[model samples]
Target: MLLPLLVALLPLSAHAAERQVVLIAHPQVTNAALTRDTTRAIFAMRQRSWPDGQAVRVFVLPNNHPVHARFAKERLTVYPHQLQLAWDRMVFSGTGQAPSQVGSQIEMLERVATTPGALGYLEREYLDDRVQVITME
Candidate 1:
């Protein structure tokens, strides 16, 4: 009976691990970590530059994408729809521009790695050495 229970729980643990999301940046970025507030500001397009004065290039997957939704909710503490609404408001009011949208996680990884001062999130399985992970405080 205990063996059966352990076997059933194994998949649950693996699924949870697979859902983990991490913030990533271009390898040239000097900062190794960022505060959650600052990150939220950047993603919202309220912050335009890094602390070192480099222009920030924000990237994101579609609002409906599972990884996008998970990152917004778990990392940023905001719903994906809320982000979309904020972006729409800023765009309409001529106050800000929305982040560039990538079509898939593969594109997200490639864009962040190639673009200077780039910032985005990806699931752990998609991560590699081309980009650096920025830990959130």
Candidate 2:
């Protein structure tokens, strides 16, 4: 019985370990401050700008990556398919547009770290000097 329980718990433990999403801002951005709620709202198009008064521009993956999957499952509070439909509806209605999609994590980080007002997420392994990490908590 203990063995069975441990087996089940192993996957759960591994999942918990994967919860982190490394958020990064452009290197030139002087204000590195961000709250998780504010970040989420900004990415969802529910909020507009950073408190320091920079217009927010979000970069996202192309919706098939495991990191992107984690983002949708945890942060966005909606599935990828649902988010896509909502994004498309907004684009068609002109309410707002979806965040610009980058081809991969490398591209997303590369672009975000250079573009003003840019934000993107990646695993910690991809971290580089060009981007300032935003604490999600």
Q: Compare the candidates by TM-score and give the number of the best one.
A: 1
Q: Give the TM-score of candidate 2.
A: 0.77
lDDT at 55 for candidate 2?
A: 82
C-alpha RMSD values across all candidates: 1.4, 3.9
Q: Rate the local accuracy (lDDT) of all candidates.
A: 0.95, 0.79
TM-score of 1: 0.92
Best by lDDT: 1
Measured against the true structure, the TM-scores of the candidates, in listed sequence, are 0.92, 0.77
Over 8-119, each residue of candidate 2 has an lDDT whose tens digit, in order, gives: 9998877665546777898866666666677667777767677778888888887788888787777666677776777788789999989889988889888998789898
- Give me the runs in candidate 1 sitting further than 4 Å from their true place: 1-4
Stretch of 10 with least lDDT, candidate 2: 28-37
Question: lDDT (0-100) at residue 81 of candidate 2?
Answer: 78
